[model samples]
Target: MFPQSICAVSMEKTSDQVFQIIALIVLVITSQSQNSCTAKTFTNLTTDESSLLRLKAEITLDPDLTITRNWSSRSSVCSWIGVTCSTRHHRITALNISNMGIYGSIPPQLGNLSFLASLDLSSNYFSGTLPRELSSLRRLKYISLWSNGMKGEIPSWLSLLPKLEYLSLRNNTFIGSIPISISNLTNLYHLDFSNNSLQGKIPQELVGMQRLQHLSIQYNYLSGSIPPALFNISTLRVLAFSVNMLSGRIPNDLCANLPSIERLHLRGNRLSGQIPSNLSRCSQLELLSLRSNSFSGQIPAAVGDLRALQFLDLSDNHLSVYFPTGTLPLSIFDISSLQVLSLQRTNLYGNIPREVGNLTMLISLDLGYNNFTGMKTKGYVIRAFV
Candidate 1:
């Protein structure tokens, strides 16, 4: 029995010894796996499907039940409403669910749509700021969230997208300065952030956007001088900076580089100084509103040189330069395209020039509260005071 026990003891392994043997085997196997894996390939996920499904789940209200009833996991993702997929790659390229009256916050998972090019969630009740994760969409081009309840500073990441062309975030509660980095959108054409509570001086860097055409930052609480560089954007077609707290003299060379300008609205601001006499340089100008400003100078005869000038409003300003002894700015009558001319309270006093009859296209003429003894100016519907 003693000899048998000694042999058994010699052959037996302790629990610690067994555990070490198992661990060694596991280490060898794990080392082999590490060597074999050069890169991880994630699978079992349809990127577009997962991202959209997550977004649909966040809708607190859908006015038409468009998303709730139609966005089923059973259907192919391309068949879903507002989703458009590419024929070759079978990837979602556009998601325009605008004006749906749906209420929800944008899901960060939406950034997973690697092929998405256009995203339009405008005229909805979508609240909260834009998801930062949206910056991951390197292929995104168009983004519009107009008339939503979105609030917060405009994201700076918007400048990262190289191909972004159209962007409108107007009619929201966005407050703070217009980002200086917006100049980074070198390829952008149409951009509107109007009707927000944006403040601060207009960024001079906006001149960097050489391709910008229509830029509307009007109806905000923006303060300080209009950036002179903004006038240098020769590509600008519509530049509206009206109804703000902006206070400064307009640069004399305002119309020098602005060859493509059509509408120039700078009304309802605290602007002082003579209206730029170089206005004739804007050959394409159709609408000009310098009304409700503190401009104190005689009307520039250069304004008559605008062959395309249709609407001109110099109303509610101190525009009488000894006009009681002087005649009217008769040069305006030369504009055959003049449609609406409001010179209310401009302190002019003179007999209405018979050339006033030259405005055959004049539709709305408001000469109210100005010192004018007039001959009958005919063919205007909105009154011509004399």
Candidate 2:
């Protein structure tokens, strides 16, 4: 061609232009790839598939629930308020819709989320039987449907969940017997069916649940003899069977072997027989209630040995006995943790112990209604005691 120098200069310029074009193409491709990944990671959710969308729609119509519309399905669920997500992704793991005043039956479609662990639908106006479809969520661990107007028997399908640990169906209008299938929930730790219309014998198979720690079936229509197995479970720390129609002799060894017991309530039943002297073995006993039963016996002095005891109620029974005179055990007076002591309506005719003032933490002391007629004089004692 023309001149070697000019050709060389033009070649250099063309090379530079080609390099710039290739660099621009790479930049555009990289930007598009980043945007595509983001779009895929947080796919836009339609109103039909979004539980949050439906919740928001309902909350919008309610004057009481001032929910914000800022909630989006595209955002990480963990970042959303009142939602807990698993570590794997932004899938909702726990939904606490308590006291939301959202009036509607729980949508059966909620079973679509397999990662859900806890569902709290308490203190609302939700009506209708719990959907059987909820049993599809195999990962569910906790379920609370208390303080609602729900009816129907406890769903047997729910007992099939492998991971269910805590269940509360208290304060509902549910009727029928406590399903025997409840024994299948071996992993359950806390089971509360209180304040319902559930009636039937305490299933003996429930004793097989080794993990149960708290069992509250109070204020129900349950009848029959108190299952002996109920007293033998060592894992039980809180046992509330109050306001039921259970009867039988008070097991002498109820808390004798259970070293982990902290609270025991057997009030408002037809339980009879002597107070177990061996109950002092419940070294960890803090709150013990034996009120309003037909128990007729002498109060055991070993009761004063409960060093960890804080609240004791032996009222409304035919207990004809003294405080088992002698100096009250150091655990009773020196513990300084006793708060409530109600011995009213018992047959105690001894002088009121002046050492009762040693309970600085005593908040409520009801010693009236007993045969004792002595009036202890001290303004601090009455002021310190409720």
Candidate 3:
């Protein structure tokens, strides 16, 4: 009953309106889908999150534990379990869970954390290969995953983290050679790969880590001469390369250049040659161990100048040296410090200086397997405390 023109105009209007409404519905669905994806990714990070949190909650009562209450109200993860976060939005900066006795594999989802500074999961029972995805944590600074049962080769991709400073993967089952790319970690300060199944020469590339302060690669299957480049690290303070298959003379200038060195352990190896007298140049030296080696020489008298020395072990070798002269520096007698000393199996025939009695601080003194008697016996009384 209506005119054709009127009907046509109404139909056109209706079609345009329907198109607009459909476009609006599509836009809404897209926005919601994106938001849901983000939520699901974060919410279901681990299907076992409840168990993880319940385990960590016990940390609040431990004498060794402390946590910020402010984050406790956030989501379980956003909450402060092992987390350290930024001041503004509380993004995690560190996640130290050392000695927690937490069992199971490390969650690869941890790689999603972009702001983490440190991740310490030491002394746990974690097993399986270390997740290589960890390389995605570009902001990571320190990582300690020692004392576990983790297997497989060390993740070579970790060298990509620009801010990494400290890395310890000691006392694990990791096998294979140290990655040459480790040299790329220029900002590294402390590195320990000790007590693993790592074999082959210490990477010469590691010599490039100039900022490195402490390095320990002991108790592995590492063979070959100690890298001469190691001695060149000017900032090095503590160096432990013991209990390996390492042979050959320790780099000559090793201790000569490390003026700041406080402790040096080169024991339990096939290392040969006289103990470097130049080692006395380590004015800050406190501990020195050269046991179980093939060293044959006189104990350097310059060693007495190491007034800061607290512990010294040259036992289980063929060293021929007499005690330094004088009332063993009064510093050595101070009961407040200087506790242990061992010179066992050294071929020495001398009188025990009476000054040995002055070392009241000595707790364990080993002079067995030697040839000291007479005057040495008197000195032995004062110093036998070690």
Candidate 4:
């Protein structure tokens, strides 16, 4: 019986050896298959070719076959559909393949493209966080990845790109607070991060980005009062912070630093206090939206002074709460260039001045749920809800 036990142990050892031998055989076959693929597909691939091929391999879907069809081992990398190589160095400089409906995870291997200047992967189905390896790119200037499914925090490492000018990551699923480190991008001209799930206060450090022309962070969970320092950037043309959890009154010196400001959107917030009359200083002001806020006090008459104002919305606010008070600013009706005016549910009480008829360009006027006594006019077919 003891000899039989020894024989059973020997059989178990034999079975283990057989399993190990099978595993080794499988490993050898896999290694050989990989070697065969390399020998057949890659003829001493260049660094750029290697990185691009890795990217192509990572892609899950290519609806138009743009990348899958054009990125060929036989073809020169310079002639690739989305690639633009430098004239002297023959290195990739620009890669733009937007609106193609491609889906993939941006592989970290792409960071090897040291000379990449512009990258536009917008309107694609790309998912996953931007790889930290991207910080290695020094020459990167323009990056637009809007309308993608990218998630996770906006990496602070992005500030390392010294020459980065335009960056738009709008309409993504990005979460977490915006990294204050973004202020380091001094050369950034346009920065849009709208329609993200970003939380926390709008960074006061943004004042350091002196070259910023267009800054939009709308449709986020951003809280706290906007930094007054933001108003100091005279280069700002568009400042949109709508549909956020932001509170506190806007700075009285709002337009003082915004000399070139054309569009200002701050709707759907918890902001209270009077509308700043200093807004009239914005000579280039075209669109002003402050609806669905807690703002009170009289609608600023100074708003009428904005001759270039095309659209003005001050609706769903606590403006003119006191009855028999809050005269609908007569000057507002004097703006001939105004195309749309909305002051719905503002408790504003007054005789709609006859000057409203003078708003020849006005097409849409919404004064619903207000206290205006009368809207007497002639020769005007405006869409109004007085």
Candidate 5:
């Protein structure tokens, strides 16, 4: 009986020892797994760092030595100039080297920055076509390559960036038609392709971009009438199609459609027809420039309703008459915010309204080449030339 009892006790002790050993093995395995995960997470940054180094090698001239001196392998790339990294994952997010006077073609290796968001290489001398590899950066939001010497057609692959908000390729030498594929960028708010040689009609597909706020395509060779659908983009704040070959009448309901418009620049075009009476609807208008167009007929009295008008340039047009014969519209002098008023070479025959003194903010008033007589000058420091 004693022997059987001892045997049972020995077996129970052995079972407890076996269970403890199994638990210890599991704890060690779990600890190693966690350590492995941490190591892998940190090592992933090496790929991003390598990609940046490759880009640095491609830059032949950094006049300020900004990138050459700062971008080094000895330190974390996040500390490098113009590089912004996220805190959580230590991934590069923004690269803003604008106005750095650097000269080099953008490297395709930049596409490897999968986490990059904003890239501003403006005011640089970078030349060559944008690499197709850039399409890999699906996370990009803002891209500015303005004032660069980059040649070739603006890449259609830019439309692939789904989250892009601001895109400015202005003052470059890009040619070819503005890509209709750009309509794919639904989130795009500001699109400036100005000062380029881009020809062809404004893409009608651009009306699909509901978020667009500023659309400036000025100084291009783009011809054809302004798309009426473009005026319907109620979110537009500045519509600058000036200095182009755009002709045809300004849409009659232009202001009614663009309730948010502040600056409407249709100057230096061959546009004709009467100034739309709906100009009164643009109560938010700050600048209205329709100079050097073929527009004829009496100036609309609704111009007086633009109380927020600061700069109005209707010079060099064929506006024949103003209301109340031989006198300027009384509302022209009533805009308290009027700063610059230019009615030069419009054959305006009238007496300068004495109420011009009411413009407290008036800085410049050019009524040159008009048939105005008996000009009574205001006491303010306005640069008036009759």
Candidate 6:
């Protein structure tokens, strides 16, 4: 009986040891699973790191060394220069390296950052065509490649970015016609392709963009009449087509459709025809620059209706007709917000009205090269050529 009791005690000890061994095995499995997850997370981040390293390699010059000195594998990619990461997914979200003087072609591998949203490489020296690989970034929203040396036909694939909104490729060496597919960006707000060597008519298809606010194609080689449909975009605040070869009669109903128009810079174009008298209908008009055009006829009496008018330039035009009484329109001086009023070289024949002094906000007044007489002012300096 004493031997039987000893065997029972030994069996109980063996059972406890088995239970301990099972618990140890379970802990090891759970720990391995947790480590696997951590390793996967790190492996995902390493891809982004590799992509950034490739980009750094393509960048031949970083004038400030901001990218070269900061981007290093010894440190986490999240802390690297110009990179912003998402805290939840641990993925890169934005890369804003604008005005960094980065010189080199953009590495196509950058398209591996599928989670990237905003990419600003403006004011750099990036050259060559945009890589088709960029189309991989389906989540991209804003893109600014302005003021760069990038030369190529603007990629039509840019329209494929589903979430793209603002695109500024202005002041680049991009050649070829503006892509009609850009109109596919229905969500686009501001589209600037200004100051490039791009030629071709402004795509009438762009009128499909209902959300477009600012459309600037100035200082380009664009020719052909302004697309009449562009005026239908009421959301446009600034419509700048200056310094182009655009020719046509200024649409008589110019301001009728542009309710939110603020700055209409049509200067240095070949626009002709009488200045639209309905211009005052654009109640939001602030800067109206019609200089170097062929607009004729008297300044419309409704000009004073633009209470927000700040800068008015009608210089170097064929505006010859004067008011029936042979004097400047009293309405012109009534604009209290007038700051820079330039009517230089416009054919005028009249006595300067005493009402001119009423323009208290006038700063730079140029009335030169006009057939004017009896010009006298009390409070303001005037440059009149009689």
TM-score of each: 0.84, 0.78, 0.76, 0.84, 0.85, 0.85
Check candidate 1 and list the clashing pairs.
372-386
Poorest 10 consecutive residues of model 5 by lDDT? 377-386
**What is the lDDT for 223 in model 4?**
97
Q: What does candidate 1's lDDT look like per residue over 15-120, in tens digits?
A: 6688899999999999888766632222123878988999998889999999999998899989999999999888899998998999988989888887889999
For candidate 6, lDDT tens digit of each residue in 177-199? 99999999999898999999989
Off by over 4 Å in 1: 1-45, 322-327, 374-386
Q: Give the TM-score of candidate 6.
A: 0.85
**Which candidate model has the greater lDDT, 1 or 3?**
1
Q: Once superposed on the true structure, which residue ranges of model 6 sit more than 4 Å away at CA?
A: 1-43, 324-327, 374-386
Give one digit per residue, the lDDT tens place, for model 5 in 92-152.
9899999999888888878878888999999999999999988988999999999999999
- Cα error, residue 288 of model 2, in Å, equals 0.3
> How many clashes does each candidate structure show, in the order listed?
1, 1, 15, 0, 0, 0
Clashing pairs in 4: none
Model 1 TM-score, all chains together: 0.84
lDDT of residue 127 for candidate 2? 79
* RMSD to truth, every model: 6.3, 14.3, 7.9, 9.9, 10.6, 11.5
lDDT of 2 by residue, 1-386 (tens): 66999999999999999999999999999999999987544422232237566555544233364345445666654666567776665477787868866566766656665677898988877778887867877989999988987899988897879899999999999999988899999999999999999888888888988888999998887788877777777898988888888887867877765788898888888888888878779989998888888888777767877889898887778877555452223345565778888777665566666678799988888776555544443212222211
Q: Which stretches of candidate 4 lie over 4 Å from their true place?
A: 1-45, 321-326, 374-386
Q: After superposition, how far is residue 238 of candidate 2 from its true place, in Å?
A: 0.7
lDDT of 4 by residue, 1-386 (tens): 56998999999999999999999999999999999987544422277788888889988999989899999988998898888888888788898889999899899988888888999999998999999988878999999999999999999999999999999999999999999889999999999999999999999899999999999999999999999889999899999999999999998778887889999999999999899988789989999999999998877778989999999988889987332333666677778899999877777666656567889998888777766566443212344321
